[model samples]
Target: MITINNEPTAYTPIFLGTTQHSLRLSLEILIMVGMKLNDEIIETYNVSVSAIELGQLPDIGSEIAIDEITGSELSGFKAKLKQSDAKIQNTASTELEKLVDLKNVGRYQLLKGQKNMTQELNVPTLTNDNLILMRQMLGVTQKELSVTMGINEKTIRRIENKEQGISERFVNKLLAVYPELAQIIEVQFDWVSLTFPDLTSKQVIDDVLRLQDNLFLERPTSQNFYTREMAFAGEKNIYIQDFAPFKNPETQAIEQKFGTTLYLTGKGTRLFEKALLEQSMNWRNFFEKARQYRGHLTRLDIAINDKWGLLNMNDLVKAVQEKRFWSKSKSYAVHGN
Candidate 1:
């Protein structure tokens, strides 16, 4: 008798020795175990069968009740038995963790609903449940994800429903395509600075003002030369600076090193949104005009906030120590003890 939920089931499970022969399984039973049998041989099996009925089975060999075996005893039994190289698991979390090296890729951490952190950081795997939640958080539909990921909508639904499993390669591919999905909680572009080489300060100011709907220009102030601060909603401000005098080392002449520069912070993007709408321009249009004016992107900072402690800062420090990252800057400063 098989005991489930402390209740005995009439049917007993039988173990078979195939001896290199192909062993067939009942799809109905496999579905009941929340797993599928592939071509390879299987040694040990542990599953919950509450969802299905075991009607009939072939009498192959002696029956061993899982409840009768200890985990160490099972390990010994499994060691003596012939098993496939591929590891198989029925649960989504177990299967996903088996496929990927989570140590290499950062673990994903998330909270339940909008409350406390109920999940542990160690066993953080990108399960189908996480995928569904992430899509929902991103306010995207299954069809939209399918279109973006180039995966079949039905396939995504199947994975989410636990009818199918996704491979590690596919998981990495998905993350590569939609890097923002890894943010899991919140992602924001905090700082943006652009330099226009060809355009004068006046031209840059005029173009910026065209997009300014709620922004207020402050009184011009002098910081070496003339500078202005544009205050927007939420107390965010944009700093505009004209070229400053610099002695060219090669020419030994006083020249303007920096062109007209505009600094837009994360908060300032809020006001910039209104400016874009007022000017009937999207980000692409604005960038296009900047390119037309020979604008150069000087700096951009992406702020990823992990409220649930998903990212390990120690791993980043170790990566920097190992020189695993690449940067355009020659030197970087690491903060924290």
Candidate 2:
């Protein structure tokens, strides 16, 4: 029995050594024992208490103490709990690493496949704005257009809004349904025109050649010179006076062909003279050379010479300067000069 504040209570011995006793009293007795032990140490005493005896005492302390064996067991249990917690944390970390590796591998494979597909198939994509514009231009509602194109209306709407990507088959279907609309939605090229004045005969010829090439013309010919029959149509008794006197038969034939008959009008004469002066060539000298070449020249020879000679040079220069020579409405075969 132990006295707690002068009341008797049962007690239990925690450790019993030879000639020694260690007691762990109940909380109520522990408090009273603490007060008594505070003043003096006591001799060894045997004590015992049953569980039923402990129930009769009033509850006083928050904590209960087990025997020494149980206390030692609790410490070992806490150590095992820490080890288990560590093992669980390590397992979670390993699983996380594996998951990350798998995700990265999947992403790499997907990217590789996409690259190969892009190279294998030459597919073109259209933007949302272009898709919408094309649909509007074709005057088709989403549902009707989708039905005609053999695609889902929701897919069409998604493509138009850029919410979803379009497939090559869908693009082809749209093109087939609205051929003109495809052209309207395509990227366009801009054309620019340039103007110049006072270009030389050579320059005009070069420009015309360039234009012909651009327009995809096969064969281009100048309209300056004419053939024998073409030059002297109504003339009669065309006889050459002296072959040596004229440098070219073509020139001679042309002179004989015209022979002062093809009189130039006042306006035509002024235009021709202006053209020659602008080209910085002597018109008189040109005619003299033509007369010299005309002696025994063939029609083709004369035509070629005249073109390369002064007439074309002067005319081309004038046409560029005045804008009057090459009008579409003006005919090349005038009766006069």
Candidate 3:
């Protein structure tokens, strides 16, 4: 089960830390501490200027006495702020850590949401309840999933009703059709040491279903959405399809990592399939993008083009940072079954 809390009292950190304390010790603090400090100073300056207009001496505070901050001090704040990634990450990480059973991508979302975490994945441990939930989420009936898996609807029903444990064969089939489900249904990180939250009531279910409409089919894009298509000759049908498959290695890696992180589950794959339809993947442009994403998909120890495998945290971050980064589809569906 997922949980979230209310907003924080203030955006600023209540307690001082080693680096912040060090920064405070610098002459920069004489004028302002950070954004919060700058905001306070600016507000006071505005109010003081108003008093001056009426011929009154503004006794703002003691900081104005000895420091008598100049505009130059404020200018230096930008440079310091530029180097604040560590502090920003530390604060966000601290809050996100409260939620367990999250991969980096899930953690990133929780941070993005709370300053919050969210999503589950595909794994053997999934309950039969999760099976029904996911089937319904994709807008597919038990018959669809059954047919897609080369099985019968009765088996799907039995699994959903908790008549059996989710077998490895079933898990493999589900992931093959929806690879991204793995991360969303299971905790794949070391920091995720806590067990699942206990069921609050009989009405409350344990599995996360079509979480946030992952199962909901998307509305087809505008009529003119597909501006390009090529005709193909089949046995009896003339097939014209939009968007070519993106087979470039680097781009695929980047898309896999970025999509895995952003969409947080199968919903991500559905979105990418959309980009393939509307977003331009013009060969020359896509080739360059593939190169850029490849650079970030590897590390000093591993050359990307020479190695193709699962990415780690640093590589995932770089892939998501790509300017041309794509997203999940607003509306999508499963059809192969």
Candidate 4:
């Protein structure tokens, strides 16, 4: 039961299925069908436990940053996931709790088709940790259990270590010591769901292009003469004004296609790479997208240039001193202005 707006709502009826079955004969039939369905659910469908958990995961909110989330932000994030987890756990717990009531109804409807309680025997398959947990729950030390079972403490430890799978006699001895363990130890697989930030292709492209545009627009330039580097690319030391821009064959030919090259110094490249790496996303996914976006942005920014500044030395200075995209490709060449 849960309270809603100051009203208490009961949750009992939902747990007990609509029609309670009776008779060992009817149960055997139902079990057969249930087993068939379980196989189809697992083998025919690709659905996995992890995927189911992920589907039920609560929204973590975009306010959670890539850098840090502390105090209330962290608390609220965890509370949402835990609330969902509790809902899942309750459904499983309620189903198990209804087992005895269903069994009673079945026996009554069948007119004592199965009468009287019989001892239930199960395999002794408890793990190392589960043995310790049962001992802890009984509030007994290993030494005490050892004496009660008439076994050495070292033997108990070895069995818990999985050196022994436990004999029929050993399980009987354990039940005598802590009988509740028969009902307490249930094996359930726990699934963990992970959440990642939402990032779009447009956002990634914009960020990469913005970095290039800043460098392009503010690049240090040579006014009247070619910088020592630009001349190597194929700049003739002719008068800057004597040629009316396109009068130079090389200038006209190059302008018709692509703009003059923009040289990205090692420094600017380093700064951009660092920022791209720090983005809050999977590193492999980020770099894969970054590499593609960087290529597109490079073409757009450098494909066109002002005639006067066709040869841009480029803005890529980190203060008065000083980078990897180029080094990774190693495509640097000494070219003309």
Top lDDT prediction, candidate number? 1
Clashes by residue pair, model 4: 22-106, 219-315, 232-335, 232-336, 233-335, 233-336, 234-336, 266-323
**Model 3 poorest ten-residue lDDT run:** 15-24
Q: Over 4 Å off in model 4, which ranges? A: 1-124, 185-337
Q: Worst lDDT window (10 residues) for model 1?
A: 27-36
**Candidate 3 wrong stretches, greater than 4 Å:** 1-124, 185-337
Residue 137 in candidate 2, Cα distance off native in Å: 0.6
How close to the true structure is residue 331 of candidate 4, measured as C-alpha lDDT? Answer: 40
Give residue 40's error in model 2 in angstroms. Answer: 99
My TM-score estimates for the predictions, one after another, are 0.37, 0.22, 0.22, 0.20
Q: Candidate 4 residues 236-279, lDDT tens each?
A: 11011111122347554522111222222222222222233234
Tell me each candidate's RMSD, in Å, in order.
28.3, 51.9, 26.9, 27.9
lDDT of each: 0.47, 0.30, 0.28, 0.29
Q: For each of the candidates, give the backbone clash count.
A: 1, 11, 17, 8
Instruction: Write the residue-wise lDDT of candidate 1 on 121-225 in tens digits.
Output: 443556788778777877889999889888789988998999887777767767777764554444444567788766544557576445332223344446645
Residue lDDT tens for model 3, 102-139: 11223111101121223342213457766676676678
lDDT of 2 by residue, 187-272 (tens): 11111111122222222223311111111111222323322211100111111111111245656552222211121222222222
